[model samples]
Target: MPAIVGAVKVINVSASSIFHIGDVYAMAPKSSAKTYAGGGSFNTGSGIHIQLSDSHTYVNDNDKFDQTIIGT
Candidate 1:
């Protein structure tokens, strides 16, 4: 099977007006600790992980994901 895995670096997303689940955004200043999910992990096709080292402001409460942020 064809698969892709990478570490994505992100920054300055707090003020963005638009958000989408699968939308790709470029990184500024390059963060770290990105991981891609696989089929065996959860019987799923593909996935991505994004993590921030420091606290960031949210526009609203709805943006927060229900699951644990670190291990998701």
Candidate 2:
């Protein structure tokens, strides 16, 4: 069986604006804890950017996944 891999990213706003403050949070299964890709709050002239990915090549065979993201 091949490993299940994927990635996700989110932002609070998607328009031409400035972010005075921003925050981000992400989490994954304990078994694949190391698979947590880099993600955090970023200030942008148009909006905030959050990037996340799953780099684990040995993930389980399951195709189901759960993720959480909090931003402000």
Candidate 3:
């Protein structure tokens, strides 16, 4: 077996969400859904209403019959 006997420096490791350093198998894509409302920020007051809905897909399964609805 081998080992590092010196100091190690890591920089700019900007995953900010997901970071992998070692070997991996079957790395599925990270599922994500983002919903943003108009005029929604820290600069001003937001007067609009925000609604979110998600009928997420089944993970690690075969969806022979699947249905999803976001909104009306």
Q: What's the CA error at residue 3 for candidate 1, in Å?
A: 7.2
Per-residue lDDT for 5-35 in model 3, tens only?
4555666554334444455564443333444
Residues 1-69, candidate 2: write the lDDT tens digits: 444545635477434333432342543323222233333533457666655564333446464545423
- Overall lDDT per candidate, in order of appearance: 0.44, 0.41, 0.44
Whole-structure CA lDDT of model 2: 0.41
Candidate 2 C-alpha error for residue 2, in Å: 55
Query: Which candidate order results from sorting by TM-score in descending order?
Result: 3, 1, 2
Q: Count clashes in each candidate, considering only residues at least 3 apart in sequence or on different chains.
A: 0, 0, 0
Name the candidate that leads on lDDT.
Answer: 3
- Please give the lDDT score for candidate 3: 0.44
The C-alpha TM-scores of every prediction are: 0.17, 0.15, 0.21
| lDDT, candidate 2, at 47 | 64
